[model samples]
Target: MRADPNLYDYWPYRDRPKIVWPGGKKLAFWIAPNIEFYEFDPPKNPSRPGWPKPSPDVVGYSQRDWGNRVGHWRLMELMDRFGLRGSISLSTALIDHHPEIIEACVARDWEFFSHGIYNTRYSYGMDEAQERAIIEDSIRSIQTATGQRIRGYLAPALTHTERTFDLLAEYDFWYTCDLFQDDQPQPLKTKGGRLVSMPYSLEVNDVITYGALAMDPWRYADVLKRHFDQLLEEGERSGTVMCIPLHAYLVSQPHRIRAFEDALAHIAGHAADVWFATAAEIAQVYREQYWDQTVADIEARGLASGGTGFGPAED
Candidate 1:
């Protein structure tokens, strides 16, 4: 059974806003580049315990060696071509297997957000202790590999338990991007304190748009550009942030990578007042500047009052 949907409402947790960016034209845009690599251990039976596995056809075709290599190179190439700094939602097991990738990430100063140890390991059934151990182990492994302590997390398959926030706070992570709250940054109430929930885009996510939707590069680029343009227009009216989630396995494909590249170039060409930022930077700003302290002084009070009324918060 699914948990009560209202459990995910996050607006009541925001702190009051403050002026910090000096110029009101500051617009923060973040790209989440997720890396999900794992050893393909084919299940012996359909009823094997764990999260549901993809069909043999999907997994078999998806795990092509050339596809993985092409995906990796495409990501590196995009980073170089656009000079883009991104948050890598990485699986610790993958990093452990590919130390060179970790080395290159260190050289490029890319931020690593924990995406658990493997893409197939679901945390939903774990006890609090087991979950905490998994979280801590991921942090330690990623930190050891990259020489940088990870501060953010994205749950595998977006599957998480109620204890996830408290566990993340216990590990001293600054924030988490598991939420689909909005196109802007906001705070999440935790047992320890308010942990910022950095917004992540499911609509523009390449995993779905490219892999699942089967959209061509041009269509994908158009979809991304439309979102960017809408966000820019909204930002001009009300200072809001845009978060775009891209997966290395999907977006790094030769056909799809060009679409992403085109979208980046389009944004850059049209960029006059946009702030392309890392997730860490966006979290820092939200923590330091935009958190709403009281209802009377909140900038986006409508969000808290169920303006969209789309998510569980409305109920």
Candidate 2:
């Protein structure tokens, strides 16, 4: 389905300059580690009580087990190895079942972005009140568990509505990754003014590489490296921002976690020229510097189109 025309308009080749990093850094990278759990509840039409039987192509029983144990540990190891903290997009239900994970995340100072109450159950068909309750409950649960108010949100399966922004604003979230309007953080004009849209990359995400392509971790690493290299080259001409979405279950597996490590090492090795920051940090910077009234002046004058395409911005 096409995006709502009234919500945004896209015009490529606008005159907005590339977003420069703090202190003239070449590229800014944001890593998002998502922890998800898919519970099973079959529809009444089905002759089953659980989710529709899983296919080999989709997540199966084997993958679920792998994601919970090996996958979770590997992600932790990668964070330790790279000396990087990430936003953990978590299922509220999973957090309830695994409170230790929440504690661990807090100890590591990781940012937590709600992925929803669970993956399989979505918020799409719910009424306004139901959706609002789901969002508020997820925030309250996370805050109670981690002692940190959730500042960002990622819709389950990226399924949401126009009201999503209003709800997020009501909850006082700093940003949401639901929209892919721009690479650098951009202002989202909501009823309450603006909130930052921190774009998440579907192209570089582990789900596409592993779940879709069925490729090995090595291949995933190669794809990541190629993207990073191209963006670094572009950074010379214009600033670039890259967001890499990772699933705790997919990237945390023993074989795949290695690729995650390799990718992080590749980026960290060049830390001098790259700025690695959380989504919150990115949004804060964009609000203070790029999306302020001065920058809005340029947008208003048609110097730059307010919305770019839904692709991640290259470095």
Best by TM-score: 2
Per-residue alpha-carbon lDDT of model 1 for 161-232, expressed as tens digits? 767887787778877888776766655646565467777778888778876788888998999889888877
lDDT for 17 (candidate 1): 45
TM-score of each: 0.83, 0.85
lDDT of predicted model 1? 0.69
Candidate 2, residue 258: the lDDT equals 68
lDDT of each: 0.69, 0.73
Error of 1 at 161 (Å): 0.8
User: What clash count does candidate 1 reach?
Assistant: 6
